[model samples]
Target: MEEVLREIYCALDQVLRKGAYINIVFSGEFKHRSAVTFVVKGVVENYFSLKYALETLAPRGVKPALKPLLMAAMFMLKHGEIPGYAVVNETVAFAGKKFGSGVKGFVNAVLKKYPTLPEPEGIQKREAELNAPEFIIEALEKDGVDPKTVLRPPASDLVHFRLGRKGKTEDLSGLETLTRSEAGGWFSMPDTRLKELNASGKITFISPSSMECVNAFGDINGKKYLDVCAAPGGKSVYAAEKGAEVTAADLYPHRVKLIEAYADRMGVKLNALQNDALCRRQEWLNAFDCVAVDAPCMGLGVISYRPDVTINKRPGDVETIVPVQKAILSEAAEYVAPGGRLVYSTCSVLKAETEEVIKDFLKKHGDFSIYSYKNNTDFGRLIMPDGKWDGFFICVTEKKK
Candidate 1:
C-alpha cells in the first residue's frame, strides 16, 4: 500500500506540477502494475474532490509532497475496498519514510479527522462529489448537460475500433459490444479486446463520434480526399478503406509517420505528407474533392478517457485554440475544389471551439455554407459524452460552385 502511495505521489507530481498528460505518464511509468494503475487513476480522476476534503480537514493546509498521499488515502478510504484504518496507517507509515516522525504524526492526525469532517453543501457539495472543477460544472449547465451525468465516470472501458482488414467480428472474443457505429465497419468493444485486435492489425481504435465525422462525408469512393490534420491516422485510414484516394497531412514528420504506419498495417495506399494546416500551398489550392480539418482544441469531450485534459487546461486555452481552429478551417476551405465539401471537426463541446468558431468562419467565408446531416444543429452537430462514447462537434460545409 505504501509503495502504491509512493507511485501515486510521483504520478500526481508529474500531472499537477510538470503539467503532463496522465495517460502518457501512467502508460510510461506504471502500466505494468494493475493495482498501482487503478489507485493512481482513481486518485487523479477524483483529485478536485479529494483536495476539497483534505483542505477542509486540514485548515492549515497540507504540504505539496503530502497532498498526493492524502488524496490517495482519502480516495481509498471513501471509495476503495480498503478499510479506512488501513488507509490511514499506511499513509502515515509512508509519510514517516519521506518526511520523518514529526510529519507522520501530522499525517496521522489529519487523516483520522477526515471522516468526521462535515460534508460540503449545495453546489460546493456537487463539485466535491463529482470531483469535477467548478468551471466544468458551470459550462455543462450552460450547455444543458446534467452536472450529475458529467461527474459520474463512464459506464464501461469499452473502446471503439474500425475493422482494418476483412475478417469475422466473431473471431474477436471476450469483448462485450456496447453499440455499432452508423459507419458500417466500426463497433465499440472492450479495451482489452480492442488492443488484441489492434495488435494483429485486424482493427484500429477510433472514437465512434470521430467515425461519424468520416461517415458525414458520405460516399467518397474514388474521390480525392485530404485529411488536413491527420495523425495517428484513424480517419485517413478509414477514408482510404472506403475507396477514397486519400492524402493525409500533419504539422510534423513524426506524426505523418504514424499515418504511414497505420496505412501500412491496414494494407491501404494513401499519401502521407508533413504540412502545416495553416499554410496555403498554391498548387494544392482547390485540390481535393473532399477535405477534413480535425482541428485540435482543449479536448474537454474526451475527459473520460484522458482525465489529464481537465487538469492541464485553463480558461484561456479555449481562446488560444479558437483562432487556430478558425485558421485551419480557413486554409482547409482553400483546399476544397469548387463545389467540394469541407468537414470541420473537434473533440470538444465548448461552444467557442465548436459553434462559435464555425459561426465566425462562415461570416468570413461567404462562398461556403453549412451542410446538414444526421444529428444536425444550426451550426454543427454536438455529440456529448454518453458514458459509452466520447463527445465530438462536427460541422460540414460545401463551397459554392
Candidate 2:
C-alpha cells in the first residue's frame, strides 16, 4: 500500500509539476500495478473534485508537494473500495515520512473531518460533481453543450479498430461490437483484448469520429489524397483503404515513420514525407484530388481519453493554436486541385478550432465553399462525445473549378 501511494505520488508529481502527459507517465511507472492504476487514474481524472474537497477540509490550503498525497487519499476514501481507516492512516504515515511529523499531523486532522465537511453549494457543487474545470464548463455552455452530458468518465474500456489486410472480423471473436461505421471495416471492441490483437496486425485502432471523417470525404476511389498533418496514421490508412492514392506528411521525421509503419502493417501503399504543413510547397499546388488537414488544436473533444487536456492545457492554448490551424489549412488548401475536396477536421468541439477557423478561411479563399455532410450545419458538423464516441468536428469544402 505504501509503495502504491509512493508510485502515485511520483507519477502525479511529474504530471502536476513537470508538465508530463499522464498516459506516458502511467505506462512507464504504474502499468504493472493494476490496483494502483485505478486509484491513480481516478485521482487524476477527478482532480478538480478532489482539490475542491481538500480546499473545504484544509482552509489554509494544501501545499503542492503534499497535494498529490491528499488528492490520492481523498479519491480512495470517496471512490475506492478500501476501508476509510486504512486510507487515512496509510496516507498520514506516508505524509510524515515524506514531509515530516508536523505535516502528518495536519493531514490526519483534515482527513478525519472529511466525512463531516458540508457539501459545496451551487456552481462549485456542480463543478466538483462533474469533475470539470471552469474554463471547460464555460466553453461548453457557450457552445450550447450541456456540460453534464459530456463531462463523464468513459463508461467502457472498449477500443475501436478497423480490419487490416489479411484480417477478418471473425479473427477478433468473443469481443462485442458496439458500433459499426459506414466504412464497413470499422468496429469497437473491449480494450482488454486490444494488446493481443494490435500486436498481431489483425486490427488497427481508430476513433469512430475519425472513421466518420474519412467517410465524409465520400468516394475516394483512385483519387489522389494528401493528409497534411498525418501522424500515427489512422486516417491515412483509412483513406488508403477507401482506394485513395494517399500521401501522408508531417513536420517531423519520427512522426512520418509512424505513418510508414502503419501503412506497412496494414499492407497499404502510401507515400510518407516529412514536410512542415505550414510551408507552401509549389510542386503540391493543385496536385491532389483531396486534402485532409487534421489540424492540431486543444483537443477538448478527447478529455475522456486524455484528462490532461484539461489539466495541462491553458486558456491561451486555444488562442495560440488558431493561427497555426489557419496557416496549415491555408497551405493544405493550395494542394487541392480545382473541384477537389478539402476536408478540414479536428478532434476538438471548440468553435474556435472548428467553425471559427473555417469561417476565417472561407473569408480569405473565395475559391472554396462549405460542402455539408448529412447532419452538418453552415458552421460544420460538431459530434459531441457520448459514452461510445469522442467529440469531433469536420467541415468539407469544395474548390471551384
Candidate 3:
C-alpha cells in the first residue's frame, strides 16, 4: 500500500511538474490502493491549491519539481489527521526515489514546514468556489451558473432515446449503454456501472454523449461526408451506419491510425487521412457535401465527468484553444461545397468557444449563413451539462451559391 501511495505521489509529481495531462497519468497507474486512489483524486481535485502551496514553499529560483506530492502532503497537514513527522518521512522517501538524495533534504524540509505555511487567499477562494479554479468560476459566472456547489446528475441519461431516421426512438435504458457505445461523448456515470456496461458489450466505452449526438444528427444514407479533425471516428461510424461515405481527417498521424481501427471494428468504410484542414489543401478544398468540425476548447461544460478539469485547467487554456477553434471553423467553411452544410460544434458552454466563435466565423465568412435549423433551437435545449448530457453547442452553416 505504501509503495502504491509512493507511485501515486510520483505520478502526481510528474504530472504537475511537467504540466502533463493527468488523465493519461491516472489511467496508467490504475492498480494502486484505495487510499492512494483517494489521495490522487484529492490532489488532482485540489491541484490549483496544491500549485499555490508549492509556489509559497519553494524559492522562486528552485524548481518545484515535486509540486503534486508536496501539495498532497500539505493537504494532509492542513486537513488530514496524519502525524506531521510521518508525512515528512514518507514524502521525503518518495522524493529520494524519484529525484535522488540530492533533493531529499529539500523535500523533507518542505513537508516539515508544511503546517507552518501561511494561509493563502487562493485557498479561501477555492473553498468558496467549491475547489474549482478561479478562472472556471469566472467563466461560469458569465453563464449565470454559480459553480460554488456541486451539481447532481439527471435521473436518466441526457436523451431518453435517440431519434431514428424514420422518427423511431431507440431507448437506452442503462447509463453504461451510453458510455460503451459512445465514449467520445462526455457524461458523468458511476465507474462501477460503466465497468459493468463495458463487460456487457452494450456500448464500446467512449464518451457519454456519443449516442445522443450521433442519433440527434440522424443518419446519412451513404452520401459523401467529411469529418474534419475526426481522429477517433465515433461520429464517423455513426454516420456510416446511416450509409454515408465518410472521409475522416486529422492533423496527427497517430489519431488517423486510431480512427482507422475504429472504422474497421465498426465495419464502416472510411478514408482516414493525415491532413491539416487548416491548410485548405486543394484535394479536400470545398469537396464534401457535408463537414463536421468538432472544435476543441477548455471543456468547461463537462467538468462533472472530468472532475479534475475544474482544478487543473486554467483560464489560459481557453485562450490557447481559441485560435485552433477559429482556424478549424475557417477551414471547415471552405470545405463545404456551395449549397452544402458545415456543422461547427464543441463540448463547451463557454461563449468564447461556442456562440462567440460562431459569431466570428460568420463575420469572416460572408458567403455562408446560419442554417436556421440550429439557430432557432431553444438556447438551452441540447446543452444541458448540469443535467444529463455535458454542455454542447452545435451550429450548422450553408455555403451560398
Candidate 4:
C-alpha cells in the first residue's frame, strides 16, 4: 500500500513540476487496475479541491515543491480505498525517507487532522465538490451556461469505434448504435477492450464529433484537405477515409509519428509531416480546398476525458491562448482556396475561444463568411459535453470566390 502511494505521488509530482500532462503520465503505469486508475485520475480530477483542503489543514503552509506529494496523500485519505491510518503512517515514513525527517512530523500532523475535520464550506465547498475554480464558475455564469451543466460523470464504459471503408454494418450486431452525426457512420460497444478491438483492424477507434468536423466540408471526394494543427490524426485520417487528399501537420516530429502510427493501425494512407502553423509556408498558401483548424484552447469542454484541464489551468491561460487560436485560424484561413471551405473547431465551449475568435477573424478577413448548416447558428455549433458527446465548438465557413 505504501509502495502504491509512492508510485501515485511520483506520477503526480511529474505532472505538477514539469507541467507534464497527467493522462500521458498514467497511460501505461496504472491503466489496467481499476482501483489504481481511479486514484491516479481522481487525484487530477479533484486536484484544486485537494489543494484547497491543504490550505486550511496546514498552518505553516506546505512547501511549494512538496505540495504534489501532500495533495496525493490528502486525496487518498478522502477518496481512496486505503485505510486512513495506514495512509498517514506510510506517508509519514515515506516523507521522512524522501524529503528528510523534518517533513515527517509536518506530514503526520496534516494527515491526522484531515480526517477529523468537517467538510469544506463556502468557496472551498463548491470547489471541492465541482473541482472548478472560482474564476471558471464566474466565467461560466457570464457565458450563460450553468456550471452544473458541465457536471458530468467520468468517461463512458462504451468503446467508440468506426469501421474501415471495406467494413460492414452487419458486423455491428448486438452493439449500440450511436446517434448519427450530420456526417454519419460511428458506433459504440459497451464493456469491450479497446486494445483488443483496435488490434483486430475491423474498426478504428474514433469519435463521432471528430468526423462531424469533416462532414462540415460538405463533399470532399478529391478535395485537398489540410489539418493545420492535427496530430494523432483522427480528423485527418477520417478525411482520408472519406476519399479526400489529406495532408496532416503538427509542430513536432514525435506527434507526426503518432499520426503515422494511427494511419498504420487503421490501414489508411495520408501524408504526415511536421510544420508550424504559425509560420507562413509560401507554396502551400491558398492550395487546399478544405482546411481543418482544431485549435488548442482551455479544453474545458472535455474535462471528463482530460480532467487536468481546469485544475492545472491558471486564470490567465484563457487570455494567453486566444492569440494562438487566432494565429492558427488566420493561417488556416489563408490556406483555404477561394470558394473553398474551412472548419474551425476546438474541444472547448468558452466563448472567447469559440465565438470571439471566429468573429474577430471574420472582421479582419471579408473573403470568408459563416457557412450555415443544420443545428448550427451563424457563429458555429457549440455542442455541450453530454455523457455521450464531447463538449466541442465547430464552425464551418466558406472562402468566397
Candidate 5:
C-alpha cells in the first residue's frame, strides 16, 4: 500500500513538475487489489482540488519538494476516513523516504497545522464528480446551469440493461454487464459492452467524434473521397464502409499509421498518407468529388469525457485554434468538386470554433452555399452541455458548378 501511494505521488509530481498529462502518465498504474485503490483514485480525481487546498494551506515559505508531500497528506487527511494523526504519521514517513529525511519533520509540522487552514467551500469538490473543468462551470453558469438537471450517479449495469428491454436496439440474452448509465439518451456502456457486442457480431468503433460527424452528414457512395486531417481515421472508415474509396491525409506519418490501422481493423481500404492539408499542390488542389474536413479546434464539446483538458485550456486557447480551423476549411473547400459536398465539423461547441469559423468561411467563398440537412439531421438542434450528447457543431457546404 505504501509503495502504491509512493508511485501515485511520484507520477503526480512528474505531472505537476514536468507538465505531463495525468491520464497518459498514470494510465493503468493505479490498479491494485487492496482498499488503497479507493484512496489512490480519490487522490488522483481530487488532485486539482488538492492543489487548491495546498495553495490555501501551505505556509508561504515552504520549499517545493515539501509541497507535494504536504499536498498528498493534506488531501488524504481531509478526504480519507482514516484518523488525521495516522495520515500525518504515514505521510511523514513517506516524505522521509521519498524526499530526504531532513524534510520529514517539516512534512509532519505542516500536516499537524493543516486543521488551522480555513477550508474553502469548493475544497469538497471532486474532479470526477463535476466531470468538467472550471471554465466549463463558468460556461454553464453563463448558459444557466439548472441544479435539477445536473446528472446524478447512474444505475447499475444490470438495471440499465433491464431498462433497455423497453427499447428495440438492445439484445439482452446472455451477457455480463459491467456498467450502465442514462446520463444521455442512450444507456452508456463500458468498453466491455462493446466487446460483448462485437463477440455477438456487432461492431463499428470510432475513436474520435469527427468520423461520426461526417458519417452523420451525407451518404457515402463508395466514390473516391478525401479525408483531410484523418488521424485515427474514424471518418475514413465510415466512408469506406459505405463503399467510398478514401484517401486519408494527416500532416504526421504516425497519425496516418493510426488511420491505416483502423482501416485494417474494420476491413476497409483507404489510401493513408502524410500531407499538409493547407498546401495547395496543383495535383491535389482541385481533386476529388467529396471532401471531409474534421478541422481541429478548442475541444469544449467533449469535456465530459476528458475532465483534465479544461484545467489546461484557457480563453486564449480558442484563438490559437481558430486560425487553424479557417485554414483547413478553406483548403478543404478547394478540394471539393464544383458540386461536391464539403463537410466542416468540430467536436467543439465554442462559437469561435464553430458558427463563427463557418460563417467566416462562407463570407470568403460565396461560390459555396451552406448545405441544408434535407433529411439527415435536425440541423439546428443545439446539443447543450446539460444534454445527452457532447457539445458538437457541424456545417455542410457545397461548391457551386
Candidate 6:
C-alpha cells in the first residue's frame, strides 16, 4: 500500500510539478496500477480542497517537495478503502526514508490531526469541488454559464469507442451507450476489452464531440471534407464513414500514424498525411466542402476525466493558445469551398477558445456567417464538464457564395 502511495506521489508530482499529462505518467507498469490511478485521480479531482485542508491543518506548511506526499496520504486517509492507521503508518515510514525524520514527524503529526481538522469550505471548497481552475471558472462565468451548476468532480473511468458500419453491436459484450451517437457512435467499454475490440478491426476510440463535430455537417454523404488538425483521426474517420471523401492532416508523423491506425481499425479508408495546418496549400484552398478544425487549446472542458489538465496548464495558456486557434481557423477557412461549411470544435468551454475566437474570425472573414446544426448557438454549443458526457465546444459556420 505504501508502495502504491509512492507511485501515486510520483504520478501526482509529475502532473502537478513537472508538467506531465496524467495519461502519459501512468502508461508504464505499476504493481497496483488501478489503485494508483484511483488515488491520483481522487487527489487531482480534490486538489484544491486537499491543499486547503492541508494548509488549514498544517498551517506552518511542509516544503514544496513534501506537499504532494502529504496530499496523497491525506486523500487516502479520507477516501481510501484501506484503514486510516495503515495509511498513516505506511506514509510515515515512507516519508522518513525519503525526507528524513523532520519531514516524517511533520507528515505523521498533520495526518493524525487531519481526521479531526475542519475541512475548508466556501469558494476554495467550491473550486476544489469543481476541480476547475480560476481562469476557466471566470471564462465560463463570462460566457453566462454558472460555475455553481457544474461543481461536482468527475467519477467515471469509462473509455468511449464506436463500432463502424461493418461491425455488429450484438456481437460485442458489455457495450454501454452514450448520448451522441450520430457517426455509428459511442459505446462505453472497460480498458481490458480495448484489445479485443481493436483486434476486430472495426472500432475507433474517440471523444463524444469528435463524432459530434462531423455530424454537424448535415447530410454530408458526398462532400469533400478536410480535418486540418486531424490526428488520431476521429472526426476524419467519422466523416469518411458518412461518405465524405476525407483528407486528414496533422503536423507530426507519429500522429498521422495514429490516424491511419484508427482508420485501419475501423476498416475505413482516408487520405492521411503529415502537413502543418498553419501553412496554406494552393491545391487545398477553396477545395473541401466541409473543413473541420479541431483546434488545440488548453482542454478545459474535458478536465473531468483528465484532471491533470488543470495542473499542467498555466495562467497564460488560454491566452497563449488562442492566437494559434485563430491562425488555424484562418488557414482552414481558405480550404472551404464557396458556400461550403467550416466546423470549428475544441475540448474547451472557455469563451476565449469558443466565442472569442469565432468573434475575431467572423470580424475578419465577412464571407462566413453563423451556422446552425442540431440546435447550437451562434458561436457554438459549450457542453459543461460532466462525468457522463464530455464538455465540448462545437460551432458550425458556413461560407457564403
Top candidate on TM-score is 4
Best by lDDT: 2
- Lowest-lDDT window of 10 residues in candidate 6? 175-184
lDDT string for model 1 (18-111, tens) is: 8877777866756337766777788777776777787778878778777777877777787888888888888888889888888988888888
Cα lDDT for residue 155, model 4?
60
lDDT of 5 by residue, 1-401 (tens): 47756765665565545555555565444554243444444555565666555666653667766655576677778777778988887888887787779988777777887778754455145333453445545554554543113222122332122111112344533345333332211234454665554334334423323444555446678566998988877677767767788899999998889888767766667899998988875776667777887787665565444434444555566678889889988988888877788877777666566677877888999988877742233332234443334556667777898
Clashing pairs in 2: none
User: TM-score of predicted model 3?
Assistant: 0.78
Per-residue lDDT tens digits of candidate 4, residues 1-401? 66776677777777767777766886656633565566767788777677777888886688976787787788888887778888888888888888899888888888888777777888888777778787887777798988866744356655456777646666566566444444475546553644455666566766667777888888999889999988979898888988899999999899999999888877788999999999999988899999999998887777767677666667888899999999999988889899999899998888889999999999998999998754465698888877656788899889999
In each prediction, how many residue pairs overlap at the backbone (N, C-alpha, C within less than 3 A)? 0, 0, 15, 0, 2, 0
Tell me the deviation in Å of residue 29 in model 2.
6.2
lDDT of 6 by residue, 48-165 (tens): 7787887788778668888888888889888988899999999999988888877777788899999997655777766676676676677668878877544454556666677776
Q: Using TM-score as the measure, what is the rank order of every candidate, best first?
A: 4, 2, 1, 6, 3, 5
Off by over 4 Å in 3: 33-36, 59-62, 75-85, 115-119, 122-124, 127-133, 142-202, 208-216, 310-317, 372-384
lDDT of 3 by residue, 214-237 (tens): 444444575678888786776776
Model 1 C-alpha RMSD vs. true structure (Å) is 3.0
User: How accurate locally, in lDDT, is each candidate?
Assistant: 0.80, 0.82, 0.65, 0.80, 0.62, 0.80
Candidate 4, which segments miss by more than 4 Å at Cα? 151-155, 174-189
How well does candidate 6 match the true structure, expressed as C-alpha RMSD?
A: 3.2
- List TM-scores for all candidates, in order: 0.87, 0.88, 0.78, 0.92, 0.75, 0.86
Q: Compared with the true structure, what per-residue lDDT tens digits does model 2 show for residues 269-371? A: 9999999998899999999999999988777777777776666666677789999999999989999999999999998887888898999999999999989
Q: List the residue pairs that clash in candidate 4.
A: none
lDDT of 3 at 232: 78
Worst 10 residues of 5 by lDDT: 158-167
